[model samples]
Target: MQKKSLDAVLERLMTVFAVDSDSELARKLDVNRQTLGSWRSRQSIPYALCVNISEAEGVSLDWLLAGEGEMLRGGSISPTSKPAANPQEDAILALFRSLEETDRREIQSAAEEKKRIRDIEQRLEDLTEALAVARRPA
Candidate 1:
């Protein structure tokens, strides 16, 4: 995997930390806002601060350095995050994730199919009960 440039790393860190600007990042890193502004504008940031950002955001150091590995340690996918590991599971998750975007629409459709068959059987019981009730003395 190609190593991500320092700027790219910082950008991801900023996004992961949910900070809108480098000044906010500097505040979190306990560094001067001017230093962070220079770093972001010039594509330079301290290694120590990088490490701090990774630790604070639960990112793997390796992934931060290179985009090859999972971004999050726990393999969670944020709105801007990418997939991490378990190739097989990832494929399965992709399928489920690709399902039509509705409230359990796939599951509900399958359940409705099953319910149709169940309703047929239930109607027989209902008919039998109705006949028994009709045949009984009033």
Candidate 2:
């Protein structure tokens, strides 16, 4: 799957939490305000936190990461009960399940780096748009 922007993922998180500010998100996550600010400034999110939220709550990881599926899994499925994983997803899950703990940690680190870069790119894009708007005459 094509990687989604970190900013977009963050927006989805906000939608899930019904929050409009980072401070609120931080509070809901049980993290300090500075911690959240650090993550935003550094452009790196804690993958484990997202995973914990997904498992502890009923939220869907696919929707949080790639925005591919519904907001929730299991009981939140449609009336007919949509399948959780497609064939490709099934294959990936099988492989992922077989991996060593260290290997999984490596993959998680790589994902965090990718998300950091995506966040930076999104911030740059937003800044560029603001600049363009500022240059426009009244």
**Winning candidate number (lDDT):** 2
Worst 10 residues of 2 by lDDT: 1-10
Error of 2 at 108 (Å): 31
lDDT of 1 by residue, 28-96 (tens): 667798876677566666677668767887887777765457766766557567545788988876775
- For candidate 2, give the lDDT: 0.73
| Candidate 2 residue lDDT tens string, 1-138 | 122356666666765665667788788788998997777766767888889888876789987776676667663647566766689989876786577534544565566779999999999999999999999998
- Candidate with maximal TM-score: 2
Q: Evaluate model 1: give its lDDT.
A: 0.66
Q: What are the candidates' C-alpha RMSDs?
A: 16.0, 13.9
